[model samples]
Target: MQEWQNACQIAAESAWGVTTDATSVQSMAYDAVRDGTSLKSQHAILATHRVADTLRSITEKHDRGWDAPKPRFTSPTVVYDERSMSFLDDGTVSLATTEGRVSATLRLPDKKDGYQQQYLDDEAWEHTQSTLHERDGAFFLHIGFKKPAEPSRQPEYGTVLGVDLGIDNIAVTSTAQFFSGSELEHRRRQFRRKRRRLKETGTRSALRTLIGIENKERRIAREILHRVSNGIVAEAERYCCDIIAFEALDGIRNRLPAGDVFHSWAFRRLIEYTTYKARSAGIRVTRVSPEYTSQRCAECGHVEEANRSSRDEFVCQSCNARSNADYNAAKNIGERAVRCVQQSTQRTSVSRYALKSGTVTPDEGFTPRDGGVRG
Candidate 1:
C-alpha cells in the first residue's frame, strides 16, 4: 500500500461514446509487460494509464515544456452498478470487489502492493462531474474527486491580474499582457496562417492532413492554457496570495455582434477549465460581473473614448494613465473579484430552522460552506 496524498487529476471522458476500445486496453497491458511489470486486470490498467497521462500533461504545463515524468498519487478503482454485467462475476479469472471500502478505489490483485489508504484523513472530498461525455458505444462513468476546503484569510491583493480570453489565445493574462514578447505572438500568428491554408486546400488528402493540424492546434492551445494557468497560479502561490480572480463571463459570447466568430471558439470553456485547475491547486478563483471591464480605466475609473488608444495600447485621457490593453483589463477583473468577495462576506444571513428535529434548512441558491460559497 502506498501513502495517500492530497491530489487532483482529470479523467478521460471520450467526447464521442461509452466503453473504451479493447485494442487500447490491450496495448496498455502489453506496455505494462514490456516495462517488466506484471499485467494488471483490464479495468485496473485502464485507470492507471489514465492517471499517468493526466499527471504527466500537467507537469509539462508548469515546467514550461521541460520533459518530466508524470506524478503518481492514487490507486485506480474500477466501478460498476447493481445491474451491470462483469466477466469476473460468477468466477472465470475475474476479480471481485473487496468489502468494507469506498466504491471509488479499486484494488488490483496483480498489484497486491498498490496504494491502500490506512484510514480516512478527515479531508472532505467532492465528486466533480468533469464532462457529461460519451465513449465506446455509450456514456460511462468519468468523475473527478477533489479535496474542497474553506480558505482562511485573503492576500494583500495589491496587484491584480487582469485576463482577457479570446479564440486563438484562450486567456491573455496580465503577465502575457505586459511581458510576452513578439516571438510568442508571431508563433501564434503563423499557426493561424498555416491553419487557414490547410482549410482552403480541401481535398481528401488535405482534409486528412488537417486532422494532424487540428490535433497540433488543440494540443498547442491546451498546452498554452496549461502554462498560462500554471504561471498565474504559481505567481499567486509565490506571493502568498489567497484569491485568483476574474469575471464570471457567463454570456459574453451571445452578447457579441451577429456572425461574430468568437462564439465558435468558446472562451468560457477556457475559464471553466482554468478555474478547475486553479481551484484544485488551492488557489481560489473569483468571478465578478463582466459588464464594462474593458471600457473603464483602471487608474482613474474614467470611462471615455480616449482611454482606448488602439487595439493593444490603452491610454486614459482623464488621468493620462497608459498601459497595455490587456493589463488594464486583468486589473479590472482582479479589482472586481476582490470587491465582490469583500461585499459578499459582510452580508448578514440567519438560519431559519424548522420545528421538526430533522427538518432540513433549505440551501437556498447558495449554501454557505467553510465561509466561502460553493453552491
Candidate 2:
C-alpha cells in the first residue's frame, strides 16, 4: 500500500499543471507503464486518471470564481475498478499489485449486528470500485457495491426531517434531537494543545508522535461522524420521515469571517454519509439554501439578525417566539423541503399538460419525476 501510494504521489505530481483532460493524462500513464514503474499498467493508468480528475475539479472550481488553490498530492490511495480488482464469493478480494495479483481476506466486524456481512453475503450486489490505502499501521481495502434495484416506499408520515449541522452541536433535527460535539470539541482542543507543544519542541520524536496523533484524531472523528450519521438515519426511520433536508452550504466558509476553521469540520462528509444511508433505506435527501436559515424564525417567518441573539438562542421579534437556534433553523429547513416538493409537483403537472397538448418539448427544461431540479 505504501509503495502504491508513493507511485500515486509521483503520478499526481507529474500530471498536475500539464492538462485537465483524463484521456491525455491516461496516455501519459501508458508511457509510465511502458517505462516499467513496477506497478501494473492498469494501476498506473488509474492513478494518473485520478490526478487528472482532481486537477479538473480544481480548475472547474477556479473557473466558477472560487479562489481554489492547487491541490497537493502527499499520500493518495490506489483506486481499482472491476477490471483491476475482483471480489470472490468467499469474501476474499483479489487485487492487482505491483508484484502481481494478490488476494486478501477482508477483516470485518461481527455479522450479528448487520455490519459488513450484508455486502459480503448479498448475491445481488455488484462490485463497482475499491480503494486500497494504508492508515496508521493497518492497510485497508474500501470497496463499493451496487445493490439490485428495489421499489422505494414513500414516507408513511409524509413529513420531512430537517437537519441543521453546526460546529458546536454536530447536528440538530426538526424532530428535536441534538447530536452534541462537546466531547469532540474537547478532544480537538487537547490535540491542538499537544500539537502546539510538539511543534515548539521541534524534536524528531515529537514530529513522529505528532503524525500519529493527527491520524488517531482523524480516525476518531470519522468514527464519531459515522455514529452520528447512523443515529440520524435511525431517527428518520423511527419517525417515518420521507425526506431528509439539509443546508446547501457551498462556499459557506467563504461568506463567514474566520472561515478556515469552519473548513476543518467535516460537515460535508456528515451530509454525504447521511445521504447514502438514507437512500439505502428509501428516504430522499434534499438541500436548501443556507441563506438566513439561522436568522429566520421558524414560527412567524420573521427574517432579521435580531431573531438570532446568539449562536445558541433564537427569538423572533415579530411573534415573540423563542427556541434553540439550530432547532429553529431545522424547522425552517423542513418547511423549505416541503415547499420545494410542492413546487416540483406543480411544475410536473404543468409540464404534463403541455406535453399532452404538444405545446412544449421535454427537452426544454421539463423536470423529471425524480425531482432533480431544486431551488
Clashing residue pairs in all predictions, respectively, total 9, 0
| Model 1 per-residue lDDT at 184 | 38
* Reference-based TM-score of each model: 0.48, 0.52
Using TM-score as the measure, the top candidate is 2
lDDT of predicted model 1: 0.46
Candidate 1 lDDT over 1-375, as tens digits, reads 111111112222220122123344334433443243322343334444444445535544543444554444454334322222222322222223322222223333343553212112223754332222235544334434455533322232222344655433345554343324343345556767887787898788877877876666555655555556666666554433456666666545644566655333434545655565665555556666886677778666788766888867899988889886766776666556545655575322112111111111223222122333211
lDDT of 1 at 98: 26
State in Å the error of residue 279, model 1. 1.8
Candidate 2 Cα outliers beyond 4 Å, as residue runs: 1-157, 251-265, 345-375
lDDT of 2 by residue, 1-375 (tens): 555555555666666778756677777655654364677777777777776767766754543345777665566477888889987778688888878888988777775775567876778887776877778868787878877543322322155678888777888887678999887777888888999999999999999999988877766666677778888888776655667888886634444457446234577768876876686676777787787888888767889999898889998989989999988888777767666665675221111101111111122332222432112
